[model samples]
Target chain A: MIIGEQKPFEEIWEMVKGHKQLTVFGCNTCVAVCHQGGNKEAEIMASLLRMRATQEGLEIDIKNGGIERQCEHPFFESAKALLDQSEAVLSLACGIGVQFVAEKYMNTPVYPALNTTFLGDVKQDGFFTEKCQACGDCVLGVTGGVCPVSRCCKRLFNGPCGGSSNGKCEISKDIDCAWQLVVDRLQALGKMDDYEKLVPIKDWSKDRAGGPRSFKLEDF
Target chain B: MAIDAEKIEQPKSPEKVRDVPADWKANIIAFACHYCAFAAADLAGVMRLSYPSNVKVVRLPCTGKLDQIYLLRAFERGVDGVFAAG
Candidate 1:
């Protein structure tokens, strides 16, 4: 899922300070799964804002609201009434959700409350580790299900670098050498021969080098 | 991206856990590797050497197997401090 973390409260307050009416919008999807942006988080943020405004003698009308998913137009329709009543929206969603709201509501200023971190898997409750870079290529079959491109600090394809010591990366003791893991998995799976074959250079055009990407369905 | 006013409140301070009593002992988790730290701990016990009663020792195959998540979870679970011994 897309993982993100809430920006500091001070930064969020600065964005909505001038607006008389503001809505703390939450997206109950990917960001919610990461525990960063959700209904409960939106309410907490609204409460914090209210406390701050009251302490500073600022007259601000802040409302807490959430939608199932902010990236879809139909889902945003549920928030139309709340959005119409607000001068600005403080979106507690990932970057994509914030941009989608801004595009749909051109008149109202939309601000992001979270920094979109990465595409990752929740290893455990409140713990996430990155697993992909969206390089538009798949090599997991030969690599024994480990992603050297993303897991390897140096993105080395051929083999483990000389810097790997005691099966750990030179960058840090906490980091496992990605190539070492790949070779171990391959050996255990009886696919050691795959490691002997040198991997070819990746094509840059297939990745971000081509700029923003899109997909279309012929059936649609 | 820009601050409109200089009067914004500073970020809230981190929530403080309840303070321990004056006589409360510290809770420390020691991740001891089976090869060395665990053996040493065992030897210390055999020799009848006294150590802090509050220290909890966990034996692992190797200290390298210890993940950062384990340390974080320990703190979340109210462990005051932790150290990995290899």
Candidate 2:
């Protein structure tokens, strides 16, 4: 899921304090899982903003609202009234959701309440780790389900780099060497033979190198 | 019966704004766990022990059930400080 972190309160206040009527909108999907930008979080943010406004002697009217998914148009129907009445919107969604809201409400100023972090997985309760870079090409099948592109600091294709030491990356002891995980998984699965085969150079064009990309389903 | 939104009373603006008055007191919110802190508070009450009058105690099922939004809401409602006791 796309992970995001809320911006600092001071910075967020600086951005939206000028607006008299504001809406703190949240996306209850990926960001919600992280306990950052969900509707519950949006309520907290709105409350904080209200407190700050009271302290600053500002008479701002702020409301909190959210939807299941901000990136999709259908989910926004429920929030249409709240959003339409907003003079400015503080979007607590990923960058995509913020842009989507901004695009939909062209006249109203939309501000991002979160810093879009990365495509990651919930490693544990209240813990998340990056799992994919969305390089547009997947190589997980041959790599024992471990992604070398994102996990490996060097993105080495064939095997562990010389810097790999005791399953840890050379950069940090906290980071697990991606190749080491792949090798260990392969050994456990008795597929070590596949590791010996040489992998060709990855096509850079398939990734961000190709520039802004899009996908469409013809059947739809 | 239907209610009228226009009849809702508006909040009065703060007279001091950002300035703190000499008579101002810290309003603290304490989230006490049912099994631990709440029990301790109950014992303290039974023993006639005194705590700060400003510290309002909110009993929770467990400290683990305390959410961040609760603390934020406490502050938003103009509480000076808040803590969870488990």
Candidate 3:
């Protein structure tokens, strides 16, 4: 699920006031799962926006369009008819969805109503941390499942640096040393030999250098 | 040709009347996908399960197609809230 923050009501008011017609969009995928801009959120925002418009003495027309995901083309197409009537759109999806809407709806002005937050894992209620950098190359085997790229402050693949102290990283006393954690896990699993196998220098070109990449498989 | 001039400029205004209670009329709009939420609401109606009378639901083929502007417009037109499903 995508984590996002709602835009200030005052800021949203400014955008809708200038336009005679507007559309408020919602995505039910990531943002919805995170409880930001889903069907329920769409209704709430629309209700509040309308009230605010009335209070401001503005003759604005706002509509709501909740789709599965704004980033996907097939889903964005669902909004085509609504775009016909509106001069502007206030998207409640993540940054990508906002851009996708603008990219698809050429004549209609698209505005982001939510700030996209980081890509992280929800470890527990109300707590989360980054677990992967999406560096393109995955090397979890040697690290015994503990991702140094994510857990390590230095992203060191070799030995733990001088920062490794008391089984914690020098960056923070509370954070466990990534290498130490890796070693302990490997030892527990009797797989320390996996680390003994030397890994060659990482190819930076292989990591995101090729730009945003994807592979489409017609068949699974 | 259709009517022109003053005809196009005509206004629609109702005659003033005495104040009357409206039972706190609220205009709630629901942008429901035809697949799920709409069906559930339909079932709600079929069962005669009464909810807040203010809600007005509009069904769509899919929630994916709703333009964000429509939602904002509902509120602009004094709608209370909206809901969707896909």
Candidate 4:
């Protein structure tokens, strides 16, 4: 899932204080799972902004609302009324959602309340860890389901580096050695023979180096 | 006698702190859990112990029920200080 964190309240206030009418819009998908950009969080943000406005003697009309997903147009159908009336929108979605909203409303100003972090997995309640770099190449099949692109600090493909000690990466004790994990996984699956097969140099053209990527359904 | 809905007095919204005069006292809100804090406050009242009149106690099922939004809402509505007691 896409993980994001809300920007500082002071910074958010600085960006939105000038507006007379504002709406705090949230995306109730990926970012919501992290307790950052959700409808409930948007309401809290609106309340904080309102309190700040009141304290500063500013007369800004602020409202909060959200939809299931902000990246799609169909989900926005229900939010037309609130969004149409807004002078400026403080979006509590990821970068994609913010840009999508900006594109949909050409004339109105849209501001992001969150900083898009990474594609990650929820390690535990309230804890998220990055899992994928979206390198546009699948190595997990041969790597025993471990992602060297993301898990390995150096993105090593062949085997563990000299820094691997006691199954921990040299970069941090908390991080597991990606290759060690791969070897262990392969050993468990009786696929250690595949370890001898060396992987060639990666072709990163399929990644960000080739510029923006897109996919379409040819069947459609 | 049947109660008249129209005759009932509607509660007015709180005045903004910024709008208040210079000599105005702070308006503090206390969220009290019914299991302990609320009962303690009630006991205090029974004992005729004097407390700050500016403090308004709101009863909750539990202090765990308190949300961050509730605290911000208090400030948004011009409250000076707020505390949650379990």
DockQ of 1: 0.04
lDDT score for residue A83 of model 1: 89
Q: What ranking of all candidate models by TM-score puts the best one first? A: 4, 2, 1, 3
Worst 10 residues of 4 chain B by lDDT: B6-15
TM-score against native, each model: 0.72, 0.83, 0.63, 0.87
Best by lDDT: 4
lDDT of 2 by residue, B1-86 (tens): 23344334356544564877998889999999999999999999999999989999999999999997788877777788987899
For model 4 chain A, the run of ten residues with the poorest summed lDDT: A48-57
Instruction: lDDT for model 4, please.
Output: 0.92
Every model: iRMSD: 10.0, 10.8, 13.1, 12.0
Model 2: per-residue Cα lDDT over A63-177, one tens digit each: 9999999999999999999999999999999999999999999999999999998999999989999999999899999999999999999888899888999999999999999
Error of 2 at A157 (Å): 1.1
- Give the deviation of candidate 4 from the true structure as CA RMSD: 11.0
> Which portions of model 4 miss their true places by more than 4 Å?
B1-24, B43-50
* CAPRI quality level assigned to candidate 2 from its DockQ score: acceptable
Candidate 4, residues A115-211: lDDT per residue as tens digits?
Answer: 8989999999999998899999989999999999999999999999999999999999999999999999999999998799999999999889999
